[model samples]
Target: MKLLKIAFKSAANRKTGLILASVSIALSIMLLLVVDTIRKQGKSSFVNTISQTDLVVGARSGPLNLLMYSVFRIGNATNNVSWKSYQEIAAFPETDWTVPLSLGDSHKGFRVLGTNQDYFKYYRFAGGKNLAFAKGKQFDDLYDAVLGSEVAKKLSYKLGDKITLAHGLTSTKFAEHGDKPFRVSGILERTGTPVDQTVHVSLQAIEAIHVDWLSGSPSPIKISAEKAREMKLNPKTITAFMLGLKNRTATFRMQRKINQYRAEPLLAILPGSTLAILWNTLGNFEKILVAIAFLVLLSGLLGMLTTLLSTLNERRREMAILRTVGAHAWHIIALFLLEAFMVVLGGCILGLIASYVVQLVAQPLLVQLYGIHIDIMFPDAEQWAIIGGALLLGLFFSLLPGLIAYRRSLQDGLVLKV
Candidate 1:
C-alpha cells in the first residue's frame, strides 16, 4: 500500500515528462494498429472478393495477369478469345455456367465491361451473394447500361442519365467514343470488388458501340450512328470468360482440355489458386510494412528511455529523502517500473481508440475509391499478441532506468549525496 502511494506521488512529480512519453507511445501504437488492420483487411478483401468462383479462362498469360485483369481491372488482356471459344466452352457438359467479358473501353476512367445477363446471375462476391440492384432495373436494350455503386456515386448518375465512353481507359480525349451514348438503367449495390468501379453493359452493346471502329483506335472514316445500326455488329472477340463447373471433379479435365485446345491458345486457371499465387507475389510488400511499423515502435521505446534517463538526475534528492525514510532500493526500482507500466498502458488504450476513429473516417473513401472495406472492430488474436508483445517490450525498456536508480541508491547509502 505504501509503495503504491510512493509510486503515484513520484509519477505525479514528473507528470509533464510522463505525458510526453505516453503521447509518443500512443502515436506509435496508433500507427502499428492501423497498419496491421489495413494489412489484414486488405488480404481479407482480396480473398473474400472471389471465394466462390471456380475457374477463370483467358488468353495465354500468367495466372497473376488473369487475376489482375479480371478481378482488379489493373491491366489489359494480352489477347482475346473468340466468341466461338466462349460458346464451345459454355456448351460443355461439365460447365455449369459462363460469363463472357468484353473489355478495351472506358467511361470517364472507369473500365466498361461487356457481359451477358449471366454475369449478374453467376457473379458472386463477399460470401456468395448474387448481385442486387440498388436502384432501377437491369439493362433491357442495347444502348442501356448499368453502373457500379462507385461509378454512379462518383459521377452522380441517375437512372436516365446518358454517358459517352472515352476511347481508351485513360482520361485523355484522344479517342472518345462519342457517337454512341448509353443511358444508365441501373446502379448495382456495393460489393467491394472491381465490379463497384465498373460499367456493365451487354455484349451486343459493346459490339454496337465499336461497329465502325477497327482494333482499339478509331477508324479514319467515321461511320454514322444510323449506318452502324444497319450493319450487323456482333462481337467476335472477348477479353475473357469465367466458368462454373458442374462437376468439381472435372475441373482438372476441363482445364487440360482448354489449355490444349486445337483451335486457339488458351488457359484455364482455378481462381483460388491464381489468387493465392498473386498474393504470394505481393505478400512481401505487407511484410515490409510490418517491419517498418516495428521500427517505429522501437523508436518510441527509445524516446521513453531518453525521457527517464534525463529526469533521473533531477530526482536524486527526492530519492535520498525516500531512502532516509527507510524505503529500500528495490522499492525505488518498483516505483519507476510502475510509472512506466502506467504510461504504456494508458498509451495503448489511447492508441486503440485512435485507430477506430481513423477507420471510421476513412471507410467511405476506401470503399468508393479503392474498393476496400475497412472493418473497424476490436483487434483479432494476432493483434492481441502484438499488443501483449509490445507491453512486455515496454516493461523491459522501462526497467533500464529502474536498474540505474537501484545501483545509485546502494552506492549513496544513508547519505544525502548528488
Candidate 2:
C-alpha cells in the first residue's frame, strides 16, 4: 500500500509526461474497438439488407453482378427479363409472392426503383421486417412516388413535392423526364438497407415515363405526363425479381427450375449464399483492418515506453531520496511497475468511455449516410480478450523502465549516508 501511494504520487508529480502516454494508449484502444465494432455490425447489416426471400432472379449474368444490381443498386443489368417470363415464374406453384424490380432511371444520384404493391407487401429486410411509412401512404396513383428516408432528408423533399427522373442510372441533362414529374406521396422510415437509398415508384409509372423514349433518348414527339398516364402503361420488361417460396423445403427445387427456365437464360441465386460470397470476398479487408489496429496499438505502447525511459534519468534523485528513507531497490522497482499498470488501467477506462460516446454521437449519421445501424453494448468476449492483450502489452513494455529504476536505486544507495 505504501509503494502504491508512492507510485501514485510519482505519477501525479510527472502528470504532464504520463498524461501524453495515457492519451496515446487510450486513443489507440478506442480506434481498435471502433474498427472492430463497425466491421461486425456493418457486415451484419449488409447481410440482412434483404431477407425472407428464397430466390433472386435476373437475366443471364454473373451471380455476383445480378446480386449487386438487383439488391444493392449497383451496376446495371446485362439484359431485362420479359414481363411474360416474370408472370409465368410468379405463377409457379412453389412461389409464394414475387416482387419485380425495374431499374435504369435515377433521381439526382439515387437509383429509381420501379416496383409495385408487392414490393411493399412482400419485400423484407433485417430479418423479415416489413417496410413502414414514416409519413403519408404508399403510391396509389400512377404519377405518385415514395421517397426513402435518406432521399427525403438529403434532398429536402416532402409530401406533395415534385421530382423528375433521368432516363439512365445517372444525371444526364439531355435525357431528363422533365415533363413527367411525380408527386412524393410517401416517405419510408429508415431501414438501414439499400431500400433507404432508393426512390420507389410503381412499374406502371416507369412505363409511363418511357412512353416517348426511344433507344435511351426522347422521341421526336413526346407524350405529356397527363396523356401518358391515360395510355396503357404496362411494362414489357423488368431488370430483376425476388421470390419467396411457399414451402422452405422446395427452395432448392424451385431454384433449379428457375435456372433451367426455357423462356430465356436466367440466373437464380439464394440470398443467403450470395451474402456469404460477399463476406468471403471481403474477408481480406477485415484482416487488413486488424493489422492496422495492431500497428496502432504497438505505436501507442512504444510511446508509453519512450515516456517512461526518458523520465527515468530525472527520477534518479527521487529514487536516491527513497533509498535514504529506508526504501529497498525492490521497492523502487515495484513503484515504477505499479505506476505503469495504473496508467494502463486508466487508459483502458477512458478508451471504453470514449468509444461509447463516439458511437452514440455517430449512430444517426451512420444510419442516414451509409445505412449502417450499429448496436452499442457491452464488450463481447473477443473485445475483452483484446483489452486484456493491450493491458498485458502495456505491462510488458513498462517492465524495462521498472528494471532501469531498480538498477538506479542500487547504484545511488551506496552514496547515501543512511
Which candidate number maximizes lDDT? 2
Clashes of each: 0, 0
Worst 10 residues of 2 by lDDT: 409-418
RMSD to true structure for each model, in Å? 2.9, 3.2
Best-fitting candidate, scored by TM-score: 1
Question: At residue 268, what lDDT does model 1 achieve?
Answer: 89
Reference-based lDDT, residue 332, model 1: 79
Question: Which pairs of residues have clashing backbones in candidate 2?
Answer: none
lDDT agreement of model 1 with the native: 0.83
In order, candidate lDDTs are: 0.83, 0.87
Candidate 2 residues 1-418, lDDT tens each? 8788888988998888788788877887887788788888889988889999999999988998998899888889999999999999999989889999999999998889999998999888989899999999999999899998989988999999999999886687787899999999999998888788889999999999999988888899979988987898888999999999889899999989999999899999998899889878877888888788788778878888888899877787788888878987678777877888887887788888888988898776776555567889799898888889988888888888988887777686545433
What digit string (tens of lDDT, one per residue) describes model 1 on residues 289-370? 7788788778877877888889887777677777778888778788887877887888788888888888888877767565
- Residue ranges of candidate 1 with Cα displaced over 4 Å: 1-24, 224-227, 326-331, 357-370, 413-418
